[model samples]
Target: MATFRKHGKSIRVEVSKKSNLQLATFDIITQVREWTALAETAIIESKSTDIVSNKTVSDTFERYTEEISPNKKGAR
Candidate 1:
């Protein structure tokens, strides 16, 4: 699972998963910042008509993929 916490001007992201030996935590601040910047770029560069049509369709498919396949067993 992932948890996001906001404090003042910064955001904190925590990712956790279960394991047999120990628990691991990753502090992914830079990754979150990069993703936020990419999302902002996508919104800014997208045309209104594109957003109303193709952009919405693409976003829906992306969300569906993320929801169903967040990880892969052999992925690195």
Candidate 2:
């Protein structure tokens, strides 16, 4: 679900905890609705969770630093 609220002069729409889809100025409420629908559909159809749920950002970065970094140009 997307929540819309006023932000300065623009409308901010939060799709989820990690996702934010911005809307244009307050005058363009119609476009905001359309864009919201498109954004929501794109998010749903993208299967984004499948790409991210494999590992957390901290874990992935730590693994890279522990393993891949050693093979990089400089490893002390």
RMSD of each: 14.9, 5.2
Q: How many clashing residue pairs are found in candidate 2? A: 0
Best by TM-score: 2
Candidate 1, residues 1-76: lDDT per residue as tens digits?
4456775566665433331111222256776756545544444555213323346777888986787555756444
Q: How many Å off is the CA of 5 in candidate 2? A: 0.8
Query: Candidate 2 on 1-76: residue-level lDDT in tens?
Result: 7778888777766564236343334446687788677767767777444345567889989999998999988888
Which regions in candidate 2 have their CA more than 4 angstroms from the true location? 17-27, 47-76
Candidate lDDT values, in order: 0.50, 0.67
**Candidate 2, overall lDDT?**
0.67
Best by lDDT: 2
Model 2 residue 67 distance off true place after TM-score fit, in angstroms = 9.6
Q: TM-score for model 1?
A: 0.30
The clash count for each model shown is 0, 0
